[model samples]
Each structure stands twice: as C-alpha cells, then as structure tokens.
Target: MKQKTIGLLGGCSNVATAEYYRFLNEAVNTRLGGWEIAETLIAGMNFGNIEAFVRTGDWDGLGRYMKTKIDGLVAGGADVILCVSNTLHKPLEDLMDRGGVPMIHIADPTGVAMSAAGLSKVAIFGTKPVMEMSYLKDQFQHRFEVQAIAPTEEEQCDIDQIIFDELVKNKLKDTSKARYLEIADRMRREEDAEGLILGCTEIFLLIDQDDRPDFPMFNTARLHCEAAVDFALS
Candidate 1:
C-alpha cells in the first residue's frame, strides 16, 4: 500500500499548526522506529480571513473558502483530511459535506482518549463557541459517560485573553500560566472534574503537566495526532 498523506487544515495561528505538525511527525517517527515521518499535506490559510469567517459565523463563506483548500489537498494527493483548529471545525463540517473527502473528526479521537482514561467528568477549556456549543459535549457524552465542565465567567474571560492575546500571538506569559493552573485547581475542587481536557490546540502553549499535577491533562493535539498516526498506518 502507498504511504497515506494526511491533509492538515491549519492557520488558526502558526503555533497550533506547528504543534500539530510536530506531534504527528514525532508520533509517526517514534512508532515506526526510524527517521521516517508521516507523509502530510498542509495548507495554512490566512488567519485574518479565518477569524473573520468565524466571528461572523458565515458557514457559506467558510465552506467555500475551505472547499478551495480541500481541492488543493486532493490535487496534492491527500488521502484524508484533518482540521487542526477546534474552532475551525465549525466550518469544517460544512466543507467536508461538500468536498467529498474523508475528513477526520479531531474531537472524536479526544473522546476516545477520554473514554480510555475512564474519566466521568472532564473540564473542557476552549473558545466561547466550543464551550457553549453541544458539538464537543455531545461527542464525549455519546462515546463515553463524560460530562464536560467549563471555567467560571471570570475564568472564561481570562482564558479567552490568554489564548487570543498571549498563546495565539506566540507570547506565553507567566501570568497566563498561573491563571490556567488556578482554573484547573478550581475545576477539580468545585466541579469535581476528574481530569482536564485542553480542548483548544493552542492551550498546550500556555499550560501543561506542571500546572495540573493533581489531575491527568488530556492534550487534544496529541490525541488528534495519535489518531492520525493510527489511521495512516492502518
């Protein structure tokens, strides 16, 4: 069989895109036990335009824009597609509906990971849309008995600022790091969350195991990459 080329739809920001690429490559190389990396096709879109479409919730415009990218991936011989951004998945569903490509659902892999972890309740941290919407929650609840929890109103604002102003912009501030740990502590104490889900790919930029030693932190980026590795190798 030919080596599968995974198509990555990135550009929520360069950092998260970099993380996805690094994670996928690392996982493939480690598993294969050689210098060979996963074959990938990436089309990094304009972040400004992506932000505009997301802010307006313009599914039609988003779908059209993504279709052009998907077409390019097909032309580049990508066998499967994966969107690196959680927020972009809003538009991705529509694009996949029209693009006729087998696109991987990034959240589904994370859902499976959560199931494997045996977590009954997990704290989900991400953008407002992801936190408010049923898409991610439904995926987790249906696959596992996982109940997703979010930060408090104040904590949400802080997280939003950290992600947008700091993490996305590639400035990981110490204050933002502290805030995330504080939020994680509260999630465990108040919400009784069994673990934390870094639902946003950019989140790994600011927080990690050092911040939340008390609970297992599931990095969605790593989980998504592992799933891609399995799919590609399978």
Candidate 2:
C-alpha cells in the first residue's frame, strides 16, 4: 500500500505545529514498530496574519491567503492537508472546497474519540475565537451525539491569555496549569462534563492527564496528529 503524504499548515503559534510534527512522527514510528516516520510536508503561517483576520473580521481575505498557501503544499505532493490550529479550523471549509487536497479537520477525531468512549459531554479549552465559534462545537455535538461545551466567560478570557501569553512562548507555569485544572473541575461539576478537551493546540503544552489523573483529557494536537498519521498510513 502506498502511504499518503501528510501536509500541514502550522505555526499558528509555532509551538503547536512543532508539537503536531513531533506527535505525528512519533505515532507513526510507534505503530509501525521501527524507525518509521510519516512523510510530511509543512507550509508554515505567521500567527500575525491569523490574529489580524480574527481581529479585523476579514475571514474572506484570510481564506484566500490560506487557500493559496495550501495550494503550495498540494503542489509539493501533499496528499492530505491539516490546518493544525483549533482556531483556524473556522475557515476550514473554504480551503477544503478548493478540492486540491483532502483536508483533515481537527475536531473530527476528538468527536470520534468522545463517541467511542461514550462520553456524553466534554468541555473545551482554547482561545476566545475557538470558544466563541459554535461550528467546531456543533460538529462534535451533532456528528458524535455528544454535548460540547466551552468555558465560562471568565474562564475563556483566562484560557485565551494563557495560550497567547505563556503557552505560545513555550513557557510553562504550574500555577497556570492548576488554574486550568480547576476550571475543568468546575465544568464537570456544573455542566456534568464527562471529559475535557485541550482544544487549543498550545494547551497541551501545559496540561495533560498527568496533572489530573482522574479526568479524561483529550489533547487536540496529539489526537489531530494521530488522525493525520492514520490517514497517511491508511
């Protein structure tokens, strides 16, 4: 069987994309039981452009720019493309409609995992844009038949700050991680969430199951990379 080449649009934080690269290659090697790694192509994007689009509400312009960039990856032999950012998944359809390459959505795998685990509800952590955007949450809810919930207004602000201020810069503070854990607990208690989603690719840097052993945590970057590698090897 021929392996599909994985193409990635990364650097939404630079940190997240790097994690995706690591996780995808690691997963491929583990599954193949050798030094095997994915044949990957990456088209990096500046975080500034993404922020500008969100700030200025110029999604159309952002879509055009991403579509053009992804075209480069497709031309370079990318069989499948991954946007690689939870926030950027908002403009996902625009790029996918180009029909140049098959695009892997970030939330789809999470939804699938949730459904398989019989989790009825999950709380997501990410930037303001990711939390505010209902499309991603809807995909999880409608497609997987699970309730996808976001943080409270205060929690959203803090999580957004943690992603932009510390996580993106590769900084890790136990205090901030603890705060995130607290919020997840609140979601479980108040909303009856069965699991937690580290939706922002950068969030996995600070929090994981190690910190909260009792809680079921879904690391989006890791899960997305696993899905990418599965597609490549399929």
Candidate 3:
C-alpha cells in the first residue's frame, strides 16, 4: 500500500505532540517492518498562543491561526491532517468547513471504539473547556449513540488543574493520579459510566487501562494515532 503523508498540527502541549509523532512512526514501522516510517509533516504551534486563543473564546481567531498551520502542512505535501489536541477540534472543524486536505476528527475513532465495545455510557476527563464543551460529547451522541458524561463542576476543576499544572508541564504526581482514579471510580459508581474517555491528549500520563483492568478506557491520543496510521496505509 502507498502511504500518504500524515500532517500533524501539534504542540498544544509539546508532550502529547511528541507522543503523536512517536506513535505514528512506531505504528508505521510495526506494520511495514525494517525501518519503515510514516511520511509526515509537523506544524508545531506555541501552546501559550493557543491557550490565549482558547481562554479568550476567540473561536474565529483560533480557526484562522490553525488554518495557517494546516496550510503549511498541505504545502509541504501532507495528504491528510490530524490536530493533536481534542480541545482544538472546534477550531479544526472550522478550518475544515473552509475546505482543505482530508482530516481526522480525534473523537471519531474513540466513538467508534465505544460503539464497538457496546458501551452505552462513558465518562470523560479533559481540560475544563473540553469537559464543559459539547464538541466531544455531542459528537459521540450523534455519531455513535453513546452517552458522554463529564465529571461534576468541582471534579472538572480538579482534573483541569492537574492537566495544566502538571501533565502539560511533564510533572506527574502519585497524589494527582490517585485523585484522578478516585474521580473515575465515582463516575463509575454514581453515573453508571461503563467506560472512561481520556479526553485530553495528556491525560494518559496520569492513568490508563492498567490502572483498572476491568474498566473500559479509551485513550483518545493513541486511538487517534492508530486511526491516522490506518488511513495513511490504506
């Protein structure tokens, strides 16, 4: 199969951005064997700038900023695009509306996985905006018929704090991890959430499927990368 160049619009947090690159290359090599690598283009943005755009609720400005990044990737021969941040998909979709190379929506793969797993309800963990926003929840509902749940407002603040104050900065603490798991447990017990979506790209840094073997967990970053690799090799 001929591989298409995968364009990554990243650095919403350089940590997750780097993981996307590594996951893409490793997946390609595993499939093809013997030093094979994905044809790729990375347009890394300054997180501070992206954060500012998000915080100010400047959707138009964010869309325009991301469009410029996507333009560079297309100019560099990228056949497809993937923005590495879940929260940024709103702007990414705005860019899509204006037309460009084919792009993957990060939530789609996770939604598909949820449907395949027969999960009717799932909890989401992400930045404050991501949890409060409908971008992912609505997508899951409309596309997969899955019910998406976000933690309570207090839980949302705690998760958001950990993401920005620790995970994005590459600081992982056992206390934070424990608190996250406690929240996950509460979601499961109270909301009857059958699974959990690691909605933030950096969330996997704190906890994963291994933390609770029986609970269904969707790591959006890894799922997104796998989907991109599948498309690249298709």
Candidate 4:
C-alpha cells in the first residue's frame, strides 16, 4: 500500500499546530501499533502575518498566504489538507474551492462527535469572531438539529484574553483553568447545555474533562485530529 500523506496548514500559533501534529502521530501509532508513524507535510507560516490577516479579516491576504502554504504541501506530496486553526478556517473554504485539494472541514468531524455523543445542545467557546459569526453554528445546525450556544460578551472577552494572550503563547496558568471551568459550569447550568464544545483549538490548553466534571466536554483538537488520522489512514 502507498503511504498516505497528510498536509497541515499550521502556525496560526505554533502551539495548536504542535498539538495537531502530536495528536496525529500518536493516534496513528496507537491504532496501528509498533513504531509506524503517520506521514505529514507541514507548512508553518509566520505568526505575525497570520495574526495580521486574522485581525483585519483580510480574505484576499489570507487566501494568498494559505495558497502558498497549500502549494508547498501539494508539492511535498500531500493528499489531504487540514487547517489547524478554527479562526483561520474563515478563508479556508474559498481557498479549497479554488485549490482543487481535499481539505477536511473541522466542523464536520465535531458535528459527528457531538451527534454520536447524543448531545442536543452544545455550548461553543471560541474567539469573538467565531462566536459572533454564524459559520460554525450554521454548519452544525444544517447537518444536525443541534443548538449552538455562545458565551456572553463579557465571557467572550475573557476567552479572548486567555486564548490569544496566554494559551496560544504557550503560557498555561492555573487561574485560567479555574476561570474556564467556571464558565463551563455556568453554561451547563444556565444554558442547559448537554455538552461543551471547545470551539477554539487553543481552549484545550486551558480546560479539559478534568475541569468540566459536571458535563461532557468535546475537545475540538482531538476531534479534528481523529478525522485527520482517519483521512490519512484511509
């Protein structure tokens, strides 16, 4: 059998990218056994450029940057492409539309996991733009009859501070974990959410199943990585 090649469009911040890479290799090795590792093509871009494009919502600039990344991946013999950042995925649809490469949409696997978990309503925690925009919610709603709940304005700012300023920079603080757990508790109690979806990849850095003991937590990073491993192995 030919070795499958997967492409990763990462470096939105190196932390999430590293997580994806580690998750892919670990999942593949664990499932297949032995020291066999997954083949991957990575194009890590400059964090400054990615942040600038994301802050300004420059679709053209983002598409251009992604194109360069994808070009390198394809040239390196990647069969499928996956973007490591959920926020950066805003421009991904357009890029994949024109690029003719099979890019896995992270939300699809997340919806699958949520559906399998028998969750009717899930609270989404992410940056302000992803929470405010209807992209992820609409996608999930169209596929499944799931309600997507977001954090309040104050909570959004809090998440932004933790994710962008701290977690993405690889500075994990115990206080941030407590704060996220508090927000998760509120969502479960007030929103009546069946599960919590860590919509932002960076969220995994702060909170996990240990923090949200009252409700099931869907780690998007793990979900995305599982899908990528499946695609690569298939």
Candidate 5:
C-alpha cells in the first residue's frame, strides 16, 4: 500500500500538537520496523487568533480561517487532514461535509474504542467549548451508540481554566491533576459512567493513564493520531 501524507492542522494548543506529532512518528516507525517514517505536513495555526474566534463564538470566522489554512495544506500535497484539537472538529466536520478535504474527527476513534469496550456511558472532560458543545456529544450517542456525561457547570469552568492556563502552556501540576481526578471520580460514580473521555486535546497533558486501572480513559489526541496513522498507511 502506498503511504499518504497526513496533514496536521494544529496549534489550537501547541502542547497538543506536539503530542500528536510524537504519537504519529512513534507509531509509524514502530509499524515500519526500520528507519521508515510517515509522510506528514504540519500547518500550525495561531492559538491566540483561534481562541479569539472561539471565545467570541464566531464559527464563520473560524471556518474561514480553517479553510484558508487547509487549502494551503492541500496545495502542499496533503492527502488527508487531521485537526489536532477536539474543539476544532466542529468546523472541520463541516468542511468535510462540504467536500472540502478528507479530515478525521478526533472523536471517531474514541467512540469506536468505547463501543468495543462495551462502554455505554462515559464522562467527558475538556475545555468549555468541547464539553458544552453538543456536536461531539451528540455524535457519540447517535453515531457510536455511546452516551456521554460532562462535568457540572462549575467543574466545566475549572477544566477550561486548567486547559488554557496550564496544559496549553505545558504546565502540569500535581494538584491540578488530583483535582481533575476528583472530578472524574465523582462523575464516574454519580453518572454511573463506564469510562472517561479526555475530550480536550490538551487534557492528557494533565491526567492520563488508566488511573482507575479498572476504568477506561479515552485520550482524544492519541486516538486521533493512531487513526491518522491507519489512514496514512492505508
């Protein structure tokens, strides 16, 4: 099979982009079993500008921005696009529907992994945009047959702050991780959640691993990169 160039639309939070790159290279190299590597094209965006549009709720502006960047990626010979951030998947999906480019939704593999694990209900943790937005949550329930529960409004605010103030900046504090685990544990019990979805790309930079050993944790960025590797090698 011929390898395809994976276009990464990243920098919604740079730390998340770094993780995606690392995951892809490691997986691809391990699969090849030699010095081989995946063909990749990275178009990193300005997080400040992207966040401004997100904060203002200007999806049209965001869409146009994404389109422009993606156009450049496609022009540069990217066969498939992967927007590394979960929140960016909203416009990215819209673009895909319009036949803009072949892009992967970050939630797709998470839903698949959950379904295979017999997980019906899961708690979601992410930035306010990712958690509060029903696009991904609705997709999980309707398309993948997985029910998702987000943290409380108060908890959502905390998650958002940690995402922007800490994770994006590459600051991972033990206290923050403990607080995140506390919220996840509460949701896991209160919502009867079968698992937890790390809905934000930067979230894994905070709380990762099967901390509950018995429970599953879906890391969106890692799963998405794995799926991208699949596409690249197919």
Candidate 6:
C-alpha cells in the first residue's frame, strides 16, 4: 500500500499548527523507528482573513475560502485532511463532504476517550465558538452520549481573551496559567465535571495532565495526531 499524505489546514493560529506538525513526525518515528516521518502537506491561511470571516459571522465566505485552501492540498497529493484548530472545523464542515479525502475531526478521538473512561459530563475550555457554540459540544453528545459543560458567559470571555491575546501570539504567562487552573478547579468542585477537554489546540501550552494530576484532561491535539498517524500507517 502507498503511504497516504496527511493534509493539515492550519493557521487559525500558527502556534497550534506547529504542535500538530511536531506531534505527527514524532509519533511516526516512534512507531516505525529510525528517522522516518509521515508524508504531510500543509495549507496554512492568514489568520487575519480567517478571524475576519468568523467575527463577521460570515461562515459561508469562510467555507468558500477554506474549500479553496483544501482544494490546493488535494491537488498537492494530500490523501487525508486534518484541520488543526477546533474552531476551523465549523467552516470546514462542507469542505469535508466535498473534498473527497478522509477528514479527521478534532473532536472524535476526544469523545472516544471520554466515553471509554465512562465520563457522562466534562468541562471544556476553548476559543469563544468552541465553548459558546454547539459544534464540539453537540458532537460529544450525539456521537458519544457525553454531555459538555462550558464556563459561564463571563468566564467564557476571560478564556477567549486569554486564547487570542496570549496563546495565539505564542506568549505564555504564569498569571494566565494560574487563572486557567483556578477556573478549572472551580468547575470541578462545583459542576461535578468528570474530566476536562482541552478543546483549543494551543491549550496544551498553557496546561496539561501534569498541571492537575488528580484530574483527567483530554488533549484533543495529541489524540487527533495519534489518529492521523494510525490512518497514515494503516
């Protein structure tokens, strides 16, 4: 069988895109040994245009724009596609149907992990849309029979600001990390959340399983990359 080329649609923020690239190569080498790496093609867009479409509620325009990007990847011999950002999945839904390549959703693997752990409810922290909208939350409920809990509206704004102002710029602050943990702890204590879904790709930079060893964290980026490698090798 010919090795499939993985297509990455990224640049929702370049910070998370780099993580996806690193994870794919590291995983391939670890599994196959030697210096081997997965065959990959990246179609990165300008974050400015992406955010503009999103902020204006122009999902149709965003979908058209993303379709063009993904079309280029397909032309470049990309066999399967993965959008690095959870938020981008909203615009890429139509592209997934028309692109003719297997597109791995960022939520599926996380949902599987939550289900396997027998978690009925989990706390999610991400960009505004991922938390406020039904995209990721609905996927978990419908596909895995799991419920997702989001921060309160005020808390959502705080989290969204942290993601755009700090994490996307590749700036990490101890203060922001402290705040995120504080929020997570409150959710766990009050909401009866069974686990945490690090819904945004860049969140792994802020905190991970080690930050709260007593709590479960589902790292969507890691799980998504693992799924990509499995599909590539299979």
lDDT of 1 at 69: 84
In candidate 5, stretches whose alpha carbon ends up further than 4 angstroms from where it belongs are: none
Better of 2 and 6 by TM-score: 6
Off by over 4 Å in 4: none
Question: Can you write out model 4's per-residue Cα lDDT over 1-234, one digit (the tens) per residue?
Answer: 355788999897799899999999899999888887789989999988987887787868888988998889888888888898878778788878877679889888989988988888988888777788888888889997778889898988898788888988999999888888888788888889888888889888788887657688888888888898888877
Q: Is candidate 2 or candidate 5 better by lDDT?
A: 5
**Error of model 6, residue 52, in angstroms:** 1.5
TM-scores of the models, in the order given: 0.94, 0.95, 0.97, 0.95, 0.96, 0.97
Cα deviation in Å at residue 141, candidate 3? 0.3
List residue ranges in candidate 3 displaced over 4 A.
none
User: Is candidate 4 or 6 superior in TM-score?
Assistant: 6
Q: Least accurate stretch of 10 residues (summed lDDT) in model 1?
A: 90-99
**Candidate 5 local lDDT, residue 126:** 83
The lDDT per prediction is: 0.83, 0.86, 0.92, 0.85, 0.88, 0.91
CA RMSD, predictions in order: 1.6, 1.4, 1.0, 1.3, 1.3, 1.1
> What tens-digit string does per-residue lDDT give for candidate 5 at 1-234?
368999999888788888888999998999997777778899999999988999899999999998888888888999889998888888888776765568888889998999999989999988788899898999899989998888999999999998888889999999999999999889877879888999988887777775677778999888999999998998
- Highest lDDT among the candidates is held by which one? 3
User: What's the true lDDT of residue 51 in model 2?
Assistant: 76
Model 5 local distance difference test score: 0.88
Report the lDDT of model 6 for residue 190: 100
RMSD of 2: 1.4
Candidates 1 and 3 compared: the better one by TM-score is 3
Q: RMSD, model 6, all Cα superposed?
A: 1.1
Comparison by lDDT, 2 against 3, better one:
3
Q: Output the better candidate (5/6) by TM-score.
A: 6
For model 2, residues 56-175, the per-residue Cα lDDT tens digits are: 878788888788778889889999998888888888777687766788888889888888888988898988888888878888878888877888899999998888889988999989
lDDT per residue, candidate 6, 57-79, as tens digits? 89899898898889999999998
Clashes of each: 0, 0, 0, 0, 0, 0
